[model samples]
Target: MTAAPVEGELAMVGEVAEQLRDVRRHVDFFDNDVHQARDLAREADSRSLATETTVAGFARWLERLEQSNEALRRETATLRGHHPPDPQRPPRHRCSRYAPPIHLSALGEEAGDTA
Candidate 1:
């Protein structure tokens, strides 16, 4: 009958419409997820850049500190070399004044004593 055929055609059209709606919904959800992922990636990249900059700054600071320390060490060595302790002052000998001096010649008679 013509009525039966028309009903079957209408049913097919309804099923196709439902499928199309489902597909559109899935596409919208996927688009939203992709946008959120991109935003998160951008945020992570920004944080990494900030951290890298901070680390670089710290490295430069450490280098400067090392240079300053080296300069201080050189200054100290220069001062020590230029201004030696006075040697004309009396020596602080722990032994008694009457003790005989220990000559190097007594250690061995092989070489002549230089002292």
Candidate 2:
């Protein structure tokens, strides 16, 4: 009878040990997940910072481009004030497109009148 009770107690203790091992495995899995999440968060933060830095650089470049364009416009206005357009010359369009000046005198007199 004493041996039977001792065997039963050992079996119970074995079951408890197995349960503890299962709990430890679950804890380890969740711990690994937490670490992975932290790593991903850090990576996202790094990318966000890089993107912000690039945008800031672009903003600075755009500001400089606008300033240069404004300066060129002011200089062109000043030049146009100093030199009046000849009545015989064709009027220029307000555009960035460049057209080579056509010498009407080089062409026949009739070709110049075709304009």
> Evaluated with TM-score, which candidate comes out highest?
2
Name the regions of candidate 1 deviating beyond 4 angstroms.
82-115
TM-score of each: 0.61, 0.68
Query: 1-115, model 2: which lDDT tens digit per residue?
Result: 9999999999999999999999999999999999999999999999999999999999999999999997887788688674544669887785634667778786878986888
**Model 1 TM:** 0.61
Candidate 1 per-residue lDDT over residues 1-115, each given as its tens digit = 9999999999999999999999999999999999999999999999999999999999999999999997887788588674432469765565653678877767776556543
TM-score computed on alpha carbons, candidate 2: 0.68
Per-residue lDDT for 97 in model 1?
36
Go through the candidates in order and give the C-alpha RMSD of each one to the true structure.
12.6, 7.8
lDDT by candidate, in order shown: 0.85, 0.88
Off by over 4 Å in 2: 82-115
Evaluate residue 16 in candidate 1 and report its C-alpha lDDT on the 0 to 100 scale: 96
At residue 91, give the lDDT of candidate 1.
54
